[model samples]
Target chain A: MPSEAQAAPDILSVELARIAQDIDSSFDLLLPVPDDPRRPLVEAMRYAAIGGGKRLRPLLLVATAEMHAVDRDTALRVACAIEAIHVYSLIHDDLPCMDDDDMRHGKPTVHRKFDEATAVLAGDALHAFAFEILSDPMTGGGDPFVRAELIYTLAMASGANGMAGGQMMDMMAESSRFDLPTVTRLQQLKTGALLGAAVEMGAILGRVVPEGRTHLRGFARDVGLAFQIADDLLDAEGDEVAAGKALRKDEAAGKETFLSLLGPQRARAQAEMLVEQAISHLASCGAEADILRALARYVVERDR
Target chain B: MPSEAQAAPDILSVELARIAQDIDSSFDLLLPVPDDPRRPLVEAMRYAAIGGGKRLRPLLLVATAEMHAVDRDTALRVACAIEAIHVYSLIHDDLPCMDDDDMRHGKPTVHRKFDEATAVLAGDALHAFAFEILSDPMTGGGDPFVRAELIYTLAMASGANGMAGGQMMDMMAESSRFDLPTVTRLQQLKTGALLGAAVEMGAILGRVVPEGRTHLRGFARDVGLAFQIADDLLDAEGDEVAAGKALRKDEAAGKETFLSLLGPQRARAQAEMLVEQAISHLASCGAEADILRALARYVVERDR
Candidate 1:
């Protein structure tokens, strides 16, 4: 494991921290608990939202935006919006009828911590809150059209074709063998869509013209594949101490994985290839691409 | 039932049918099945969306907009949006983990018709489609800022404190006796919020001033309450064939209802009184209010 000092430069620990602080500050206002009958439900929502996680989605947005030299503060609202959407998905995914997982991020899942009923509301609230924040034109000096576009994209990313679709495929694919193409499509929708949306939102916010948008999309696509493969590797090879949860649960459950399909060494090599391609997409942007490159490397290199 | 000839001068069946037709036409373009592997899932989504119902939410929106002299065509997009939100809630509520109902609008529930996983995705797709349609400013021809407000209100109404909150409460209250006050609150959040939002959207589109907004809100609040009470009465007294599904299921489940709390006769009396109050709010709007008045009557008068 990288020491604290080494981790600082090698990965996004510092950047992720700054982004978390920024997100917490904004949600602090929008999610204030009212003393109404639904107060407990709202409190449970706050608890689920404030739970510690990697803040990967938000960091991707910020980091990608930084690559275009866009104002990091300006992207803060979108970052928070993305995080809210992610948290909402997690809450719903943990419901009894879905993944049925009892623990997440080292704490009881939302439904386990609160009643399943409250967890449902908490997830719904966060889902609504994401759009509510995104649609507020005043906060981000947001263009109404742009805000609307952002909301539309975010909703789609979190909805059927993105996270939800990925989830359905994942559920259906359980105990079944999936070819590499099928697995790629599944991971692309399940995990890559939102990550791609993060990069797209950043580029959109930067007002990067048509060509830049294409480049960013390409970069995000490669990095997203790399990111998921690394996850598969970590789950196969790492321990719970480093990964923070059960590591080999996916394999035990017989879920398809990159390593299972390609072998560990091959999967690791493929991930490196993806990272190189991702970095190549940003070469035109010069020094602005530094953090994105670091992020791509960090994706494969991190223990978690 | 009132035949076309028996309809009141203010309540033209042709006009209502036209409005419903237009709303259905608008939704047609919003849920097209893409050629992705998720196409089957999207087809199921389209099925859930296209099935016939009263289209109450859209009717309320169009009628209220008519009252404000807003063009019915201009109101079509928002009306479709409200229906999307309403339908999404229904799909999710019917999931195995939630209410677990097997039938909706006389057809098999989404999970039974498609699969549980597909149903979940169809619901998620429809939910996102609502916001997408609403946020597209080109359709509404208004300042995007105004459209943003409409999107915000819709999200909140369908979200945690509104429809989703009520759903969660309904789930928790299963087989339990909730007092009149609690039931009233649930009705407001679940049914009333969307109805109120319909009226509010019309007012926003028509650019109602502050005083007019207040009047319209009061009008919607009373009408929304009346609508739910009438729903309870229908479940209590309407014919199963006429209602298009099993009747008194809510009563059978011991779900809270106005009739349960106040008895059938009293509930009918309460619904009628609310209709009167609803009309009184539109007292000054004259001819513009006629369609709305007819709709209010329809709420209490719907046989099914």
Candidate 2:
């Protein structure tokens, strides 16, 4: 709860590590490996969900919720729900038929660790687990309307018009010629929607309806674009070991990305500009908005 | 609706067709293909969802809803929601990583007709659409608690402990020696869970609490068992063309099924017994429950 301005440079890293751990624990609580034939599926889900990644999405939700005094426990539950969706997408995207990935977060992907069928089922179970967390009376907050709203919001963000939609566009990227605007549209749907949903969900838990979410939306939008530009840069120039996965996949797939279109210099400049714009969107707020501002800075500044 | 007792032997078929049409319409309404690059993904979802299959799950939900006097349009929404889950499961289960089936309901499976990545994204999108239908205020019934409850029920039935869990067990069937009890438990989670959710969702719309669902639960349990047993029988002896998919794969995989364990005679007898028991569970109700009774009989009698 220290003022972010006075905090160390790793304010974002400290918060990221803490939220990732909390979300991991929440996933553990949600995933009870049964003493039956289904144990492997649950284990795969647990493996994919826990002990990995930057946890940026959950951090976004948690940080926004904290700004409005939402209970930490409640915030964590919503955070985990969003993270579950994120994990499921990773597992599916890494499948042999999709990205054919072998490593994630310095470890074998789920399909490589387990079999392909097990990986598919595990991804599916985690997807359902996300909704289970949002709709459950316990951990999902006391308000029925809020719970339903959360379910609806996350569903919209994850459905045909959201994350899955973006993934579809990405899948098509390999075979088609894409320019800057098309790439931007694809990223907006693929990565941007979920990030925006994370921030919007936090505001929702604080009872801030859609009309009052203008500034938060602007903050989420700029940060989301910056995050994607940074990712493209990482793919282009960052070390695979540092990124904890295969890099330069965009070039290999012949997919045009922000870095490929704008070049490294322009892309980095665009990302930094976005970070500044995102922070400016919170100009009216106090130190409570510092965490969000720091996250905007971290989006472009982080190496991986 | 005619009294099931006085109707012809095709009573079940008539109602099944009607409900299938209604559910297809609902899916059409919910899925709006975009003009953007995401169109292929949505098109795949539509092709998988709109045509094909028995639509037995939707029939079960609609029949149960009608028995409780729920609105037909509202009932169809829930029907489509449950059907969406069933269809998504079929799409994923037919993937090369899973069953690797080539055909479903006389048409190429989603993964066969569409590219593998699009199939994966379509199935994922349809999965999200189920919760979207259940959580939306317009089609999700009036009460917020009811909406949340519906989502929780479906989520539980679809998660690791339910359909996906059962799928994990099935994946293991190729390697493990499963006894009759193990197979029963697996089927209960895989197919029984969703069937129970369908009936339970209907009762939920009628404001029937969990404690009041004892008899409905019994009805669903017996029908679900009969349904799976009939499925095993069909896989063992029915025509491949009529079944619209490969047959005898259970035996090919050396997996233990009810038909494999009991032989054709005992398996057929068992399904009939379950059908009668399932019908008996509705004995306390009047003519309104007749459709359910007929559907129960259909489980044992249908050829496909």
Candidate 3:
């Protein structure tokens, strides 16, 4: 396993870029291109879907699937579908009437790059595309049952009660005094649900038994929360240039965050403890879990 | 079969009310009881899902599933799920920033009755609940694969390329001189996808194969379009009391429609032809298809 301090920065960057490229290329291959006049809309969907993000969710899915001995190739289609849904959510979230973010990942948001109308359509197309990919018989071996489960799990995690629900809570908390419990609940839903889903989905596909499933969920939950807290810490400490996103934007927005509720020192300590729990949960999962473990640590340790 | 003119005003109203009640009671029996804090949100979801509109989409699903020889009791869960997703979409559509409707089904919109934030969350929760119902292992034997496929199918129909895409087109056409082709495409996507999915999902659950699936697809396509054209004609010619929506609001909004693009008479004729096509495709399926046939015609021929 590559230690954080010993890993060459340039080599690490190159490898990450390659993984991203692979995910993007795989996604582009899966998008629908019907011969109908809706082709333009489909093309726009592909463009919006294939171009963005660090592919973190897909990587986590692939990694988790591999941990349970599921072939990466079998998991590839699901990984693409996961990213498609993630991208679609971001597109909708960035709409002018939604979060109204002008930029994402240093590029203009979907509604900015495309017109709002196209952005809306593009997002809708991407949403449909994710399901289409999931239901494509080729992806699920003509087993409607497996395809159906995949869709249900993804929808629950991504829809209101999961990620979107988390967002609603966050927006609600903007003006309210949120306690630590409230803040924890919000992040768990918003970020942890999807992350938890990513790993649990892998277990499902990998056919992991009850014990393994419980451990994977535990690891995902602790890591997800710790990672989010670290993100708050990064914003409080990092420069905007290093962060990509606006530094201290949480404070600017007057949002209730871990840092705001728990103070900087305690927040960092909590994150470290959570990371330890995450690693401990992964102890029996072996080397395949190393990348994910490192990634969780990096979540807090990175400047960005 | 209930003939259009022979179906009296009070009888039609009673039929619709009974359908709504059956659907509502079935859903109430299925949903999990959330904790106290979340109960109100769940109630709002049930209210928005059950208390509005004719249960046309659920009828399609249940009828089609029955035609494939599936027990109606077994199909009821899917029927409720379809209606839930449809209702969720309508709630979002009526948001102030979306279609901005103040009334639906002759009553104040969900957003107006509740508040905008509650409406949004209600819609979101309904979307999640639809999948939750489908995914519940005890329901439908917890057929994970079928559950996933149902979810994927509904998401595709409801998301960007299907309903949302169609809606974005409607918004765009408000300012443009959209031709018949554009109008038809929008209608098929916006209104057709979910309707088609409703029918197809029933077919999936019923395990309908061969010519039956193809025939149902054909039947649904035509019926779906007919339903939209009828809606267009109703907006142009029906009364607010009869239509249960803002009559002539489409014209006032300057939105392109089948009636606007093809005159009211031609639009009505087109709807009739589609209904004929729908009925013809169901010919090989036997008398069990009668309910579906009646429902298709009912969509276009009704006063409301």
Candidate 4:
């Protein structure tokens, strides 16, 4: 057998692909299109949730759960829950009243494909479904306390002080100038909160003690920042076809981003440094954390 | 003291008024205006959640909880959670892309007062906050299992199969014709589900057995349908100023409604019949169910 160090990258890619397929099939079963009149909403939800994106959030969740030996079935459900939230956010963000983007993941956005009202309801339904999945006894875990904690954590991460708050800050940034600290805080709340929750949820599912989960929290924090920096970099210079969405819009809109503030080279270096710091936090976990380490690196290196 | 029948209506109106005031104050404490740039979102959330409406949903929740002798604090929290969901739905429903209404509760809609993006984020945040409230041990109840159950029940009531599904059906009704049964099913899912959840949550909080809760479910189902028919009646003939929203839009849009399907006189009679049936379901509970009975009659009697 190959050395653990040499085998880590292959395992990371293989595992990510495996979880992506797993989530796709799970969502298919979870959200079948109804024969009723409301099938449009269901179809929009399925289209937005299934069929696209890197599935990075779910991969992170499942990877962390694997480190703690959580059951695959339980891990997959939590993974799907997190992914559903992510997809819902993307759908809402793409709405004409929000980001006004017509394309997402190289296809027409939900509103573009199914109209605005359907898009709104689809996103709303997906948001509710995420909590449904987490709170359901079968999907969450055998322990009700764990399920309650998952619901609490996910709700906080997604609510006023977190993702929605960050989006508000981003919109405010369009008209108001924000310092680097303010922008950093915005990214931390908007994207970092949910990413952190994904890791925390996996730890919760594994029944990891609070003290033992501290390192994972630190890892998630660093990786979340690194992920945002990478996104800014991609928007600044990456190909639209490769990125699967509009690029350079931040520049066009004069929005303050890490790229605009730090320039490409410095921002790239900062993300790499953050990734290394993220990996270091997981060092005490030994080889069981290899996939998480790979994921931290993947966040910065991914093109889309 | 007056006999139970004579005292019920007075007690209900008084209790409802008390709970409405209590909820308004609690929301004030729960959602204070933030000092950050995202204050607008918080402001919008507070505006939608706090100072307005009949607080009927929360009253239903609190009154039902009162019937089971649940703690006031626990009942209040659940009341707030259900109200949060109700307010969020109203905010989203009034969006320019949806009902396109300018006024709600005799004031400018969230989108009209702020902006569409802010309105959307605010509504989304409120939805998240509802689950946050229900899953938090301090708020939901002392029991984690109860909190988990609350989350699951609320999610099921709010998601694709419930409110969102009903909203989709309502939108579809504008273009496609629906029979009476179809419209009734739509109303049941859209509005009935949440209303039913309010009573069920009260039962759950009281630790009432599922077998014991069946009567309450039937009560909620009948009252829910009656409530919607009254709404249709108000839309068809009530004063727009008193209704606090546009009136007769259903007719203008040629949408099918209980009033259109059954005619005004018959629809009014049906609502009253439903209320009678609703009260009959609670007969086993005796005087403890008086407030619920009063509320059922109030549904058809209210001008707005």
Worst 10 residues of 4 chain A by lDDT: A4-13
Measured with C-alpha atoms, the lDDT of residue A32 in candidate 2 is: 84
Model 2: per-residue lDDT, tens digit, B1-304? 5687566657676787888788788778789889988999999999999978888888888888888889888888888888899999999999998898999988999988988888888999999999989989875567898899889999999998899999999988889999999999999999999999999998888777789889899999999999999999888889999988888888999999888888899988999999888888887899999888988888778788
Cα lDDT tens digits for candidate 1, A124-199? 6777778777877663456776676677678778776788778777776675688899889989988899999998
Q: List the residue pairs that clash in candidate 2.
A: none
In model 2, the Cα lDDT at residue B92 comes to 96
Tell the DockQ for candidate 4.
Answer: 0.89
Compute fnat per model: 0.47, 0.94, 0.40, 0.92
Q: For candidate 1, give the lDDT of residue B114.
A: 84
Per-residue accuracy of model 4 over B18-132 as CA lDDT, tens digit each: 9878999999998988899989999999989887898888888888888878888889988899999999999999998899999999999999999999999999999999998
CAPRI verdict on model 2?
high
- How are the candidates ranked when ordered by TM-score, highest leading? 4, 2, 1, 3
lDDT of 3 at A45: 70
TM-score for each model: 0.89, 0.97, 0.88, 0.97
Residues A1-304 of candidate 3 have per-residue lDDT tens digits of 5687466564335535766888777876766576644555566677667766667677777778777787777787888888876786777667666667777666677667666656655665566566667766666556665566666677788765787677677766767778888899889988888888777777767767657687888888998999799889888887766654456678987988999999999999999999999889888766778777776676667666
Off by over 4 Å in 1: A1-11, A66-74, A172-178, A245-257, A286-289, B1-4, B7-12, B66-74, B171-182, B209-211, B245-256
Candidate that would win on DockQ: 2
Question: Candidate 4 at A88: error in angstroms?
Answer: 0.9
Taking chain A by itself, what TM-score does each prediction score?
0.92, 0.96, 0.89, 0.96
> What lDDT score is found at residue A69 in candidate 3?
80
For residues B42-131, could you state the per-residue lDDT of candidate 1 as single tens digits? Answer: 677777777567887787787777666777778888888888888877787777666677877788888888877577667766777787
Instruction: List the candidate 2 regions with Cα displacement exceeding 4 Å.
Output: A1-9, B1-9
